[model samples]
Target: MNVVEMLQEEKVVAVLRRLPSETFLDVVRALAEGGVRAIEVTMDAPDGAELIRRTREVLGDRVLLGAGTVFTREQMQAAKEAGATFFVSPHLDSDLMHAAREWGVPMVPGVLTPTEVAAALRLGAEAVKIFPGSLVGPGYLRDLRGPFKDLKAMVTGGVNEDNARAFLDAGAVAVGVGSSLFPRTDLEARDFASITKRAERLVRAVRG
Candidate 1:
């Protein structure tokens, strides 16, 4: 399936940011077992490109692996080489959007206002990421749909099991869960089981 279809089917993208490289795959495995079909490893993570490569090698095509927090062409190139099928950014950048189009990689750039959302679409982005979803809440997403009814957005930042379905109901195709899906404490303690349970709850919440 295409990236957008993958996102629509999963309804959740487990955002991994600066996680320990050693156990990253283990975490991904747990998430998959819990029914998370889409995973995004932030570009800011240590050796993020290598992490994507390893994930593809180990997990194969069982999950939709993407690169998040992308900003520069170099990062995009590295991620593409590492087998990332799609990219996401926390903010909109015209150049980045253009690059993604030229390289034929699906990119979702973050936007919060009508202007940013319009700009992202004009710049050729197929989708947009509504960042800091907690700040504006699902109501804001509903409001955006009023003007951009066809908007394909993934709400990220501060997304959790309680609000995942709310965002989808508000017009988001999917939601990106970070700490809620992969809490620092759990990762530090190697609590993969807890992470898996969180993933299960989140997936159920969204799918319900």
Candidate 2:
């Protein structure tokens, strides 16, 4: 399936922002064990390209691998070659949009306003992500959908099991979750089971 179809099916993108390069595969395995199929390794992570390559190598088709925090063409190209099939950016950028289109990979660009959302769709985004979504809450997405009924919306930032359903109910096709689903304390303690459990809970929340 395509990224959009897969995303709508999975309903959650487990985002990793600061995962150590050494624990990449194990961490992903934990998530997958809990039934998460969409994983986004952000560019801010150390050796982002290598992590994307290794994530695909280890997980293969069991997961739909994605790249995040990408804002440039070079970053998008490298991640694409590393087997990334989708991407997310903190903001909309022309260069990044062009690269994803060129590679035939889906990109969900971040937007905070109707103008940005419209522009992102105009630029060919598979979907537009509402970043720092907690700032405006689910009502904002509901409002955005009022006028852009057909536009796909993905909610990101400050997302947790508690609030994910609100966003999904508000018209979000999917939600991007970070530290709440994969806490630093668990990772530091090497408690992948906690990550697995949390991922399962989050998956249920998003899917509900």
lDDT of each: 0.91, 0.88
TM-score for all models, in order of appearance? 0.97, 0.96
| Candidate 2 local lDDT, 38-111, one digit each (tens) | 99989875589889999899889899899999977888888888989889999999888887887788889999
- As a whole number from 0 to 100, the lDDT of residue 60 in candidate 1 is 90
Those runs of model 1 whose alpha carbons end farther than 4 Å from true positions after fitting are none
- The count of residue-pair clashes in candidate 1 stands at 0
The local lDDT score (0 to 100) that residue 8 gets in candidate 2 is 84
On TM-score, the candidate that comes out on top is: 1
Cα misplacement distance, residue 95 of candidate 2 (Å) = 2.1
Q: Per-residue CA lDDT of candidate 1, range 126-192, in tens?
A: 7899998999999999999998999999999888988889999999999999887888898899999
Q: How far does residue 163 in candidate 1 sit from its true spot (Å)?
A: 0.9
Clashing pairs in 1: none
